[model samples]
Target: MHFELRDYQFLKVKQYLKQKFLLFSNGASQTSTNWLAVEQSLSKSNLKYYKVYNKIALKVLTNSVYNNIKQAIKGTFFFLKLDGNTNLLTKQQLFKKLKSVFFTLLSIKLNNKIYSIVQIKKIKSLNYRSNMSIFYQFLSANLKCVYGITYKKISKQCDLNT
Candidate 1:
């Protein structure tokens, strides 16, 4: 089934991504409250993330697009110190590479979200119990790491097995 993210959820994702480089939503498909928590966390952080829709790549550069690209190039040059490896790139080549990176980033701005949807679909379609269990185990482990919580300890504190 096809699904579209709601506007608030989309905004939440943007804010979350700005403060955090990545996001992973947990809970079954029936539960969307997890995303609400994510949104709240994002709001608290005052972070704003840029979104790039993966399905649509800009083929033409309108004035605004051109200006954005120019700003991106300038920002890249400002933040990126030229290293010895730059010796391998002529000024023209470096400019080309930066432009390439700008377009690439622009094209995949929503890549992580797209990829997450794809992964969620795969997880939902799984029929094998063992496979689902294994996937959940892996996800839980990763979540523990991301949250800096020791699952074993928490589970024990809650009187549950690790």
Candidate 2:
């Protein structure tokens, strides 16, 4: 499945951040209710927590991929060469790669509620596993790292353990 990032989330947050900062100054990032505040604001914008999560996932993944390939020849032409069903990952490591990607994601943001698998199926042609499994893989892979341990080792280990 092909998926697109709904800018609805970032736009909502960016505007909210602008407003909060307008009122509260730079302290907004450190606001006591940061997570709840973001969540509530998103919901108010009619973006479910899941929708924001899915869109964020889509944005991060697409941008990561686009950056990696943006310089390789004409990007649009190159991208069109592949099967839309053929995801960015290699054939052998679909699950492991997805786990690695999500591990990176949750580390940056932890409060996501698992939404649709559309963001995921778009990542690999493989139907893949549940987002909960992806989350477990993220946590189990990183529980030991104090934010800097190599995800390289963790992801490989996760692939093996799974």
Candidate 3:
């Protein structure tokens, strides 16, 4: 979650970016480790890959990353902001979740209230995140209707009684 520090306010730009990224990557369960890299890659995939990261892949990453981040961190010190403000939490929980997100994206696991994001291994020959085809899965997920909308808009629309 990157943000522009305009004379000190730590505005919620990071939160908005974080939320939007999660919404876009809601399929694969992206851990907190490499959170920033994934975001940077997806944001600049056009330059990096000549196109936006696959919407389905992006949505998977967003959902997994955000969910992982939220669970590790509390639920107060956090609020989604986009131009205005959608603060629906406190600072403590907010910080915790964001921290967790970064760590989790990096593939770290939470243990005993402490984060351990350095013991990840790469020898598991397991099959994951590849079972579902992008076309069918995303189509079933309604990738067309909410395409290109910002996270804020998505959230607003997702809210009940709207």
lDDT of 2 by residue, 1-162 (tens): 544445655555344322211111111222456656654543433322222243443344354422231122221110001123433434244334323222111211112222223443344332335545776888977886645566777888999999
- Better structure of 1 and 3 per lDDT: 1
What lDDT does each candidate get?
0.36, 0.34, 0.34
lDDT tens per residue, model 3, 1-162: 555544123223233334321211122345567645655643332211111223322343356543444432322122222222332433344335434343223222222122223322331211123323544676866865556456668788789546
* Models ranked on lDDT: 1, 2, 3
Candidate 1 lDDT at 161 equals 40
Residue-by-residue lDDT tens digits, candidate 1, 1-162: 554665444444344443212222211122357646544543333322233332221222122222233323222111122232322323244335444333222211122222333343344332245556888999999997966667666767889543
Query: How does residue 81 of candidate 2 score in lDDT?
Result: 15
Using TM-score as the measure, name the better of candidate 1 and candidate 3. Answer: 1
> In model 3, where is the ten-residue run with the lowest total lDDT?
44-53
Those runs of model 3 whose alpha carbons end farther than 4 Å from true positions after fitting are 1-9, 13-19, 23-70, 74-103, 106-162
Q: Cα RMSDs of all predictions?
A: 21.6, 21.1, 20.9
Q: What are the clash counts of all predictions, listed in order? A: 2, 0, 32
For model 3, the local distance difference test gives: 0.34
Error of 2 at 85 (Å): 10
